[model samples]
Target: MATVHNNSLNRLSAGGLLISLGIIFGDIGTSPLYVFKAIFNQGTVTPDLVIGAISCVFWTLTLQTTIKYVLITLNADNKGEGGILSLYSLVRRRAKWLIIPAIVGASTLLADGMITPAITISSAVEGLAIHNPAFPTVPVVVLIISLLFVIQRFGTSIVGRVFGPLMLVWFSTIGILGFAYIDKAPEVIKALNPYYAIHTIVHYPNALFIIGAIFLCTTGAEALYSDMGHCGKSNIRVSWIFVKLCLILNYFGQGAWLITHQGNVLGENNPFYAIMPDWFLFYGIIIATVAAIIASQAMISGSYTLISEAVRLNIWPKVTIRYPSDQKGQLYVPSINLILFIGCMLIIFVFRKSSNMEAAYGLAINLTFLSTTILVIYFMLRKRIHKLWIVLFALIYFTVEITFLVGNGVKIGHGGWLTLLLALTIFIVMYAWYTARKIKNRHVKFDDIKKYYPIISELSEDETVPTFASQLVYLTSANNKEEIETKVIYSILNKKPKRADVYWIVHVDVMDTPHARDYTVNQLIPGKLIRIDFKLGFREEQKISLLLRKVIEDMVSKGEIDITSQYKTLKKYHIPGDFNFVVLEKVFTKTSELNWPERIVMELYKILKNFSLSEEKGFGLDSSFVTLERVPLNIPNTGNLQLRRVK
Candidate 1:
């Protein structure tokens, strides 16, 4: 499936290019609305300052977006999928500590999701102030954002159809608007020179802060790489040429306008709008708002995909995932949507203006870029590329990303702390969930299943014992084919002696590749005892009930096993036996000993578990035939008791 998809992606068409414009470039494509506004806000505008900032924007897009991501990082895809997690999956086995970078990158990317909508929408709406100066944009911005998030449950198929065309109009409009002013001050073209970029960094006032503002130009570059799987590498690469050209035209146009009014502080007038004629101002504002909403929608959808992958990878707790439409990969996560909505609302109420939100933006995403650089280095190493090329790659990207990180770091005191705090909170949750699972698995005791086969077989044939069901199924975590968890055995024999006609154990293994699905069966005791191992890709859904039924149908068709009722009366009619599923739910007991850090981790994990989906729901099992079994994790140690029993 992945191969076919990638092959199709390689063949580009007009529709593919349009979809790329809509989905892949929405974030960065909307940057012109605020990138110049942000840079000019730093200090007074001058010819040198204007030229240097535009130069920095040009090179930043080239190095960060074009070279690093489009050329290099996109090649690290995992089964035709691209993202930080997809990249991590390709090289996770090489180093266990790589999880740290993955967690940090993923968490920060989410933070970017929340802040992007706030800034983009606010910036677009702020344009209304030009006409009346007293027009309240906050309420309008809030209303637009609220509406965008509210419609998520209904799916974006209808609105999504127009995204590509609308964005096409948007890019063309901005390109024309920017091109109009370039001839007025044709000297602005010199900003494309690298010497000006160096001059601005060396001699400009508050150069780090200026670089931070420049960082916003390519903030959506990460999204460009992430959406690679959606519209094929060919489409994105081809469409980016036009997108980049439009963006540079707009930036240089803004620079031209600034140079004409050099040494003047830009207060109430925004260069993005000033470049437009007064007659087109109203329509331009409308276009900008629509573009902002489209950008926000893209971010919201990407957030859902990100959280879904995290849950499947076990780095995030399982949450309720809803398929709002039949469109592939169109999912709505209620919990995430609510969280992001509230975050955006809070940012609007607090910051109250796009300029204020700008300080909070770019900081978290800078960390994400840094994390990607680190992960990509390891990816290059695993591919067995020459070490010299690896070192050079490391030196260039590491230096560039680290410089951006430091630049954005200055925003920490000014509204940037909000995003940093949000990222930190998300990181804690991911760490606690991942580490707690490790701690729990460390003490899990597995018993060899061969020893239990005799008793299981005997119980299946015992006439004295009442049959619990015709078939009994248990979900196991044991990776070894010959071993099963002791808790599973306890549930079968010691807990209540669950007698049945046949016993089945099923194990699910999440593979490193995306979209893989295959299963194998091991018949330990022929028809009486069977084990099924399912290998599913990280992106695949875990619908065990449906999968189990299909596996049984295959086995029955091949004459490998009989699923017909063993009861004499039902057997005569050839009726299928009812199967009962038992799902083991682990709970921490008070008897378990742990250090302070471990205890803190467990406490956090418990809190997160309370909000997560139940084991049955997470695995997509039917609740009607499923039973929940609470098993104590880290079984009590009697030897460590301090008091002796009274005689």
Candidate 2:
């Protein structure tokens, strides 16, 4: 059994709590940096507009961020995992059509990954220009980004330790600042009223701008769902309440400051930092920079986890993964990290400032939010959660979300196309890779059962065969008759007669969602040989071994196999039998007939296939009873060496 850390209930230590705060809260925590400022600076500073914008921000947080995520979506956790994929897993079987929305949601999230770091760090670095007008913001931003990427090789554990205390201080500072300004302009607090928001939007001439402005307040809410597994549902829930309280206080404080210094606040350049006294400006800069980096860290780490889940589900190409800490689910993918870093740097260089990047930002975030809303509706339907409730919630949320999407849609000419374009590109690549792999696997058939049944039965009767013969298991293609004939031929040629009471043809189906439990079975073939297949639901985090044992027990009880007698010598009953398995692998050499993209995708699949689970564990066979026999099968195709047809 894996070591279970005491990260639950009272067992959680101070260190763990702090790390969770920093790593998980960074994205949402930093929203205060530009969210309110973004809304206010849209060329409308009138009392009605300010009141309306703040009101919209308030309701967006209360209803969309707090109510939807903290209350509803968080409850939808899959054994403590969250994200669009996790949500999809919970209802995919019952609502498979939901995959379309899930895919769109995931695609938009990928777009967010590329742009968030750029906007965040650029916004923070822009603060430097406030202290010294001569300081070069672009170069400084690039330097910070470069340093961030350099440290990714070491992983997040060391850095995570500092996140909690720093954010605690940051929030405290914002709250204190807000209190200072609230004493002077207390009426700003009244913006919390929903009526003020509705009134401002209705009475204001060009009220539609509030749609884009409200979208800013809920920017990182998806992170709440995506990182749900890293920190358990309870940790996030508890942490969020505190986080939200702090955020609201700070926003009110900013509004109060703006009210007190009506015409004297700094120009559009640095409104967030402008409210601080001169004595505190340096300190604020340091904190803002650190907070920005931390926010980017959350997105970076979340992106790695998302890609890992995608690879496991066969929606992404396989990349190497490394876990820096022994902590469960703490993983690092180097390839993804580098890609994100380079993309972010390019975005910063190309966009040059946060103002330009902001136009590109909302499109990705809004699309992702809209997609999640759609998926949540499907989830409600699958669970038979009342249709009236689903429709009512969906209509309200969808109308609000789509309104923001349209505002973002208006940004298409102004850098919004960048995010949409990136999303589409990734969607195409992922869709193509998935389609090609499925097509290739479908065409390649495994051997017939009759061809191998007699041999397996003969092997079962051989008493001379050792009780435990090998240490790995291999599976034959379930569709290749020629491969089966060759395997029989090779067994006779080698004089070993391929030994194992059970030889499995294993097929792993990576569904779109995380699984609640692993699936295993018996009698895929029957008495002579047991064909075991493992099905992993997308949300399940447990390794294959535990699930395999459960399957064995179920099979034994059903009289599918006699484990009781097989383990008579052992004190406790356990399945006992020496089993050897062979896997048939094919190496495809592309011919002229195949398309270039198909060939490229196939080659990538081959590389990914190398990283897949070994047949022994994949089929649920005990290590003592498994043996891997690799046999290669080749097929003829067109001479272009790009296209191949299976006959």
Candidate 3:
């Protein structure tokens, strides 16, 4: 068995710009499809409204996406990786209370993935309605989304290659189309000035509500920031120059078109498609649909990555993850895919048209952005930046994002509650899981291994005891190599007096780095007792069966303990020794005492525990050779008289 797992993210190159184009820009790239329509949907199209909205869109992208995420937050990388969790890893030790925001941010990001595909793709598909107002796009949207989810099991390794070029074409064509319409309403360019954004907020009626629609322009910036590791900060930063230009150019062109029409009410025709020339209409619609599909795929993949990281951190229940494409960080989670599919389908059915989804769109992501802002501020503080500068950064971002949150808050009555509910559910689960872990840790007691060493060695050679196997391996949670769990000691010496030629303890330590993998071995007792500690990155998967075999092979090469079967007949034939793994499964014992908070959290943890992957499966151990032992959680003391013989 070979033991190598490298999750090195796709790094920078000439093509790096393209992969960044395809992956990083998916959610934001497709924003042009519905942003203008959303702006016009809430009210009439007038000069102040149009210009003010475009100005808001311009600066929002600049300050939020450009200044905050691209320029500043991108600097907060963990081993070239960037995300809410990755960001938290930088400052978690500095402030333990910070985990709450990280949890909320990750939860909201997960919620955003479910709605992003529904809204972005639906908006593009809805473009066909311009040609024939009667076109039913819901069914088409459903089919496209369904197909996207269906293919996830196979992995995105093969299809991911083309994502970059297709996105480049997407940005280029849309940029040109927007440019073509610029001359028609050149005056809209004045809207880029900040005064218009402020003036609209100061004077426009129900301006805050309308700002909700403007907020759509920068929703993808968060997702882009999360995907930084895939293409590296350099690639993303470089690509965004072109990508931002294209986005801004197209946005200005749409503004130009809206200003030219100058009707009291903009009709059902979308400004995104309306800007397209009659000759290019068919091609434009096709291109838009394809871009939407790519964006949807990126969102689905991001969701999988988010949950996978959460599982590694124990903030989420463990679930089976598959490497469909084996392209570095690419992964497929069947359960998450199904959940997102159902959620997307439900949104499609409930909202029906892309127009109705605007209210539901930006609500949850605002929380995500706000959460990231909080985390980033703390992260900057830890870097020992000047207090004055940190204050300024926090003030600027909080003002921008808090305003967006307020704007998006108005959407709640209309449809925002849907995403909020989903986000809340996810947040509770994460918080509960994380909190329960802290509770469980408080009760975990480890005993020094020195006292048990002699006993373990004696048992290894006990002739009267039955041999469990040639080797007995135990997976331990004890962080110190010099310590062992009492339950494991009980199983070995007192429970059954089982024996083996050698005892091995394996401890896996999940590291903060994204792709790290290394192991250290300690021989507490030469030829009889050994410990192997595996240090794995959060992004890497664990396959103990294969890894253990590799360890054994290496040890044999170094002339460590032999693994040959001891029986003379088998030894003569050169048969390999048998290895047995013992797993300790914990359950909350009724004998334990706890407060309401602890009890509730533990019970919820237990309920969620059932949904998680089994210990053997999660560790990637071969279950056939594994025997699970149920151990009661720490219990309160029973008085000595309780054991007295009854008269």
Q: After superposition, how far is residue 64 of candidate 2 from its true place, in Å?
A: 1.0
TM-score preference between candidates 1 and 3, better one: 1
Winner by lDDT:
1
lDDT of 2 by residue, 581-644 (tens): 4444344554344678776767666655665545454344456544455543335644647765
User: RMSD (Cα, Å) of candidate 2?
Assistant: 7.0
lDDT leaderboard ranking:
1, 3, 2
Better of 2 and 3 by lDDT: 3
Q: Per-residue lDDT for 395 in model 2?
A: 86
Which wins on TM-score, candidate 2 or candidate 3?
3
Question: TM-score of predicted model 1?
Answer: 0.98
Cα error, residue 516 of model 3, in Å, equals 1.0
Query: Residue 134: error of model 3 in Å?
Result: 2.2
Q: Rate the local accuracy (lDDT) of all candidates.
A: 0.89, 0.67, 0.85
Q: Distance from true position, residue 5, model 1, in Å?
A: 8.4
Residues 1-647, candidate 3: write the lDDT tens digits.
00011233245567777778888998899999988888788577887788888899999999999999899999899987788988887788887898898998998988888899899888888878876888888899999999999988977776777888899999999899888889998888898789999999989878778788888988899877778777778888889999999998999899888888786587577889888889988898899888988888888888888888888888998899988654567788999999899989988888998888987889898888988989888888888889998999999989888888898989999889999988898998898889888887777678999998888888887888888888889999999889998888888887788688888999998887877779999999887889999998888888988888899899999998688877678889989778999998866676247788878888888888888899999999999999899986676566654665778
CA shift of 6, model 2, Å = 5.0
When summed lDDT is taken over every stretch of 10 residues in candidate 1, the lowest stretch is: 1-10
Candidate 3 residue pairs that clash: none
